[model samples]
Target chain A: MLAGFELIKIAFVGGLISLDSTVFGQFMLSRPIVAGPVIGWLCGDIKTGLLIGAMIELLWVGVVPVGVGVPPDSAIVCIVATAIAANKVPDAAAIAIIFSVPLGVIFKRLDIAHRKWNRVFLPVVENGIENGRYHILTFVIWLGVFLSFIKSFLFLFICVFLFNAILSYILPFIISAPALVKGLQVFMFVLPVLGLASFLASFVK
Target chain B: MKNCNIIRTFFRSLLLQAVWNFERMQNVGFLYSIMPCLKEIYVTDENRLKNAAMRHFDFFNTHPYIANTIIALTLVLENETVAPTGLPSVAASEETKSQQIKSLKLHLGGPIAALGDTFFWARIKPFCGLIAAGYVFIRGFNNIGYFLIPSLIFIFLYNMPHIFFRFFGFWLGLKYKTDVVKIISNFKIQKISEIIRLAGIFVCIFVLIAYIVSSGKYRFAGVLVFLASFILIKKNVSIISVFWGLVIGCVGAGFLM
Candidate 1:
């Protein structure tokens, strides 16, 4: 588990990065490439962050949030993975990357749920507009933004805390297995090709 | 004053998905961004303002970056309809004018979404990401400054086109009106997208060769993994499955070796 200060710092940075997911700015700050390094830098390991970020970014390059569908939440995955790797646990980066993919899918589902919840406010927004209560518009907008921040903060907090605890126990075992470690290193080195292939696959017509 | 409103709308457009909902997607945010223009156009007419607001409260979903063109075009249309002095007006009746605006949105939304998705998401984003990835692969990610370079490059490259599209799209919308699509088509995004894809593939191949040659051990395995992955992708395998399969295969191969 992260110490109190580290937890606070990660949560704060995670919350800020999460804003890029939707609330404030869609500035590519939320992109795994940027988010991974930023969080990695915060945790004192820029290389791992870049590696993980590039891997995830390439893998999901084809998955764009075009319409109503939310793509997997790559930012959260980047954050969790970078944080784990930054903790300096052997093989933790691989483990984090392996596990974080499913976590991102879970977050995508949560994002859909949040969007559905936002629907309930539509009537209130319409009523406010109809009644000339324009303040309600601002209220609804801020409320949505606030909820997004809270979701990101809580999600990052719990994931980082749990993953840290799990890694602290399992990493020692993984470190003892040189072959497994070599496999992970090889997988990490080759993973970007998959991202590149997936990216190029989009152009295959 | 008119330019100021357009500028304000552009800034507001940056937050166009702040209040996104499942029902209308970006409708509220879209309405919010255009509200300034509506207010300016329908000043002292609450009913007209209410009608304009209500008109925009319907469904809207588009790539947020590309939505700038739609917003700009909508503003231009609204201006011509409400003011109707210099620009060639579509129709005289308010109802017809509103209907025209609505149809304009309907017509533009899908095309813009497609164009934006193709240009920004598929081509530009991936191209920038691959360039950055290539950088990281070529120059090992040991130095913090070196790692930072790719992230910076990715952001700068991606956002340059994004900001340009936002500004140029709005300017074109204001100037050419509906003929903006013609202007867009002339840019030949398809050709550019193809070129970027080719470059990305080259970079990927370069990085793969570099990785294999430098390591001196995983050459055969790397080649096998690449061929296998290419086939899997060709067979329409899901990325997640392909990813896990590759990892498992690597581990299994590691054990055998």
Candidate 2:
């Protein structure tokens, strides 16, 4: 029954958490297991949160940011999906990850655009440094953090209210096999070990 | 350029300098180092240097190490005078013409990019990523504040030598430009590269064995499949392919386990 500023605070935390996936955070720290379940637990649903995180973590296991290949943002996937699903369907973690993929991609594109905007700031940053406007870097990072928090909060608030209102009435209309859902659930728990092993194997030599 | 022309070109290039900045890859620090050089070499001349500098920028984003070498060489080639330090300059030779400099720029662009991608991006980066991932896995991700220290250590361990190699290559390239063909001819693909590759593989095998031993629940089929995938990735398979394959494989294994 959280609402208003409290809701906004959690959503803002989600935003800040998501930022860890790119800059200013350990890329691994943004992985779903940590981000999703933690947020889910905060909102009062551990199983849903863990399930959602595990599912997203596996599917995006290959999405490593190597060279210029910017990986999709899983933080948004975990945050928005966990926040909404925890409040709505208590066991909707699997569905949340599946649904979050598109949102994750959208956020990734925004991230790309953000990078493009960052270009204009480089010279400003350089001039600031040269002229002893040493606070510019701090100003820029905080600006980014504030903007990120606002963006995340708005996205989560809108997504949760709209999706919950619609899905509450419509989920029954859409039918899915229980076996398929079970299989996905099973897949979720198993994939991370495989991912960790494969990732480890890359450095075997 | 003649002495006066060289001075003019330098000043002109300084004025015309355009900083190539981008946000992707977080390589702002790397790009910053080259900006002063860019100003000295490219900015001033609209007709002559601008096109080349822009081209360099396009490739620079894709391949930083190699672009650095080629640009450094270009600066040396453009500025180094045949005349003694203070001697009166003779009229310019055909080689000193701006057109020839432009032509040289075009010729070297592709080779340098290729070299940079191969040496820095292709070889070094993956090695570093793998090492870092391994380090983290072994050390664990607890006490999240300390995570940066490990990552920074990994980066320094990987990239510090690379920085040296880049400078070494550039300085060597300038001094021994004439002996390039002879040096390359003497370069043995097997002698050093294979030795290093073999050592790396041996260490990889040792780690694999150790991990398997430590993992009491390890299955041969799972390990074998993982090894196969590892080799495929080592042989340059698409990363996404290896990833999804393992995902499906693990999911199936989960049913059996």
Candidate 3:
């Protein structure tokens, strides 16, 4: 139910945030803490953004990209959830968080696919260096950045559009039902403790 | 003149993982950054230049931020190859010089990675994030400018230590050479990590209390679920499972209430 202009704005902001994952400086701009609020600010809903951002930040605090493991793309989750909530979809924030958690795994697979595709270009880079065609190196680096931007743009556009459509249908019933509304409120309140516990668990080892 | 090249190399370090590949991790970006320096040093010897480029194509991966120091150190060592007056006589031979540089990179790789991971990932990042999260939690949901405060706090707090360590690491490596590890040991990063961890616990407790007090009808159940989550996490349960478990428990409790 988001306006066309709103969707475009989300896609643009999503692409900028995605750069933090790999393309540009891995400045923690992509962290849910930062990305969520930025998306919320862009949508003019800072409260929802802060709430979702803090929850997702704590939830995935332990999922840092160390060595070779490609953890789920939490940034995408933040964007999707905040976009849904910001648009005033009832119970959309809770539902988005629940559903988007798995979406991260799918985006992570896409990330691994990109890394694999980069490998396909390695021999070309090596050959270019051997032949003194150093320009190929620059081409390959920019190609990686371009591909990352495309991936983020497409993923954000599709998830925001699709989830908003689905929530538009289901939100009315969930909003009207008193039990469901109270349950969701309680669930959101208690969720942060889980995030805090996950964070503390990291220090345990 | 040499200072400009060092500064250029520092900027290139930021892009060190742009062309990361499964084969060599950061080898391509690493080669790209050092290529200019190699070109300058081996200008008269094309084969040596090609050999130098080939030498760096081997596997290499480390914390990108900390790699600045390694790159600076490698530049110093590579420069010694072309101008050998300052280096020890034992390191004078071309073969020995390359070996020393390669071994130095290999030797520094693991320890620097551990240090970077512990300092950045474990301590600085989480500390900054917790500070922001705690700020938002204390402010409550209605504060109109809530998002701005945490965003600013996160960026400033996180970057302060990150930028400082980056410059300090590079300077220490350039000035003291192999004695950089000794300099790093003197920083007592572990103690800093411990203090941050303790502070993080206090913030989490404060937020948990806030949530409990805010819960009207579900106060008792909320306390129970929080205690259960703490015990479950302490028992080494997977985070995802514990999360879903708590969600289901909360919803089920809501139905009963």
Candidate 4:
């Protein structure tokens, strides 16, 4: 539903959110739970965002970046997947988490490329800083933001379309099975406690 | 005899606390111990005060526990009122020397910080976390903060002895550097650090297994499994594992439960 200029703004926001995970930001926004819901709410469905946020939060509870150990694609997992679920299945928490995993890995690769490109751009960045051309620095930062936004929007746009197609194909199968429904619900319940244990253990020295 | 104002000394100690950084370890402790005296007696330039502040900027940023005691001793030594008024004596008595030594240990902040960071924050703190995780797994999350008590208790017991011994070790390291090396050749204290690291690893493995087993096959199992595998298979792990694991796990649990 987003228009041309609007897409650019969304992409900029996504880039800012993604960049925060690294430097010049608190890194708090990088976490999937917080990032996912915030992005979802921006797109207009807080409830769906919350559901997906909560689901992603638990499954990825143990994933924390410390000393160069980047986990699977946390940003995309939350941003793109939540956008899809929020725009589509009002209650698609489990499905979003399952689909997000592979995409998270893909995003990690893209992030590596981003880091490498930053190195290539380092000379320009330094020259800008030295020459007092602050606009150049801003441009570099905006470029990262724009690229991240494009990646997020394109990824999410495709996913939303694909998810719609697949669900249309599979909703009938899911509706026919009461046991699968019950099993899925039960599985969702047990995930968080495991999360607590894992989370608690992280602060151990 | 009277003494230098306690307030001045206390405030200087507080300043040292602010600037303390852990990078050079105990160097700041030694430097800050003398800073109060430096400020009171020597560095009289007002501009130097600002420069000294900048030069010793390490004090503002490092660990506080170690720097304070060092600052405390410098103030104690610098109190002109506490100086003996009589003519310079040739030799001090054994009793006076022992008293001076006792006062030095009490006033010096370095040993305390070193001990506090190592024993309390490092070793016993993790044990407390381990115990807390055990209790939460056994009892529940309604009152998990209660587990903090044992950790506090552990801190007191562990920290006190650690400080006491570290003071002793600092003296011994100085006094017996040659003799100690002769006695225990090639004995780098870092070896002890490695041992502690190994212990931490063992503790990590134990807690991880416990967490997985207790969690069972919850919907977030995929996330949990992925993290565990990431650590085990990739031979790398960090704080990220815990954050993602919790986010994914909590949301799933909320949905299912």
- Predicted structure with the largest TM-score when compared to the true one: 1
Could you give candidate 2's per-residue lDDT for residues B1-257 as a string of tens digits? 22443333332221111222354233342233334444455445443333333323332333444334444455555545232345344334423543454555556555544554444433344344444444433343343344244345444755574555445545555567535424433655235444544554554455445544545544465366556766776676765566456546654554555
Residue ranges of candidate 1 with Cα displaced over 4 Å:
B84-92, B143-145
Tens-place lDDT per residue, model 3, A1-205, is 6898999899888988987776566778888889988999898887788889988887887555666667788899999998888867546788778877877889989888877767877788778878877677668777777778888998999988998888778888788877777778787877776776666666545
Can you give the TM-score per candidate against the true fold? 0.93, 0.49, 0.93, 0.43
lDDT of 4 by residue, B163-250 (tens): 5443444334334532432422244434654565466557545645655566555425644554564454244444345445544654
lDDT of 3: 0.77
* Fraction of native contacts, model 1: 0.57
Model 1 lDDT per residue over B1-257, tens place: 27788788888787788778878889888887887788888887788778888888899888888788889888888776676445455344777888999988878888878888877877787788777876776676664466678889989998898888888988898889989988988998888888887877777677767866766766676677677777788788988899889889878766776
Higher-scoring candidate on lDDT, 3 or 4: 3
Where is the poorest 10-residue window by lDDT in model 4 chain A?
A20-29
Q: List the residue pairs that clash in candidate 2.
A: A204-B204, A205-B204, B12-B44, B13-B44, B16-B43, B17-B43
- TM-score, ranked from best to worst: 1, 3, 2, 4
Task: Please report how far candidate 2 places residue B170 from its true position, in Å.
Answer: 5.2
Instruction: List candidate 2 segments past 4 Å from native.
Output: A1-205, B1-62, B80-96, B138-149, B169-192, B227-237, B255-257
How high is the lDDT of residue A120 in model 3? 79
Docking class of 4: incorrect
Top-down lDDT ranking: 1, 3, 2, 4
lDDT of 4 by residue, A1-205 (tens): 4445544444455555665444322224555545665667676765555455544554454454332234576666777666555555433555556566677777777665654444444455445434534345345544644565566666655655565467546655754565555545554444444444444444333
Task: State the DockQ of every prediction.
Answer: 0.63, 0.12, 0.58, 0.04
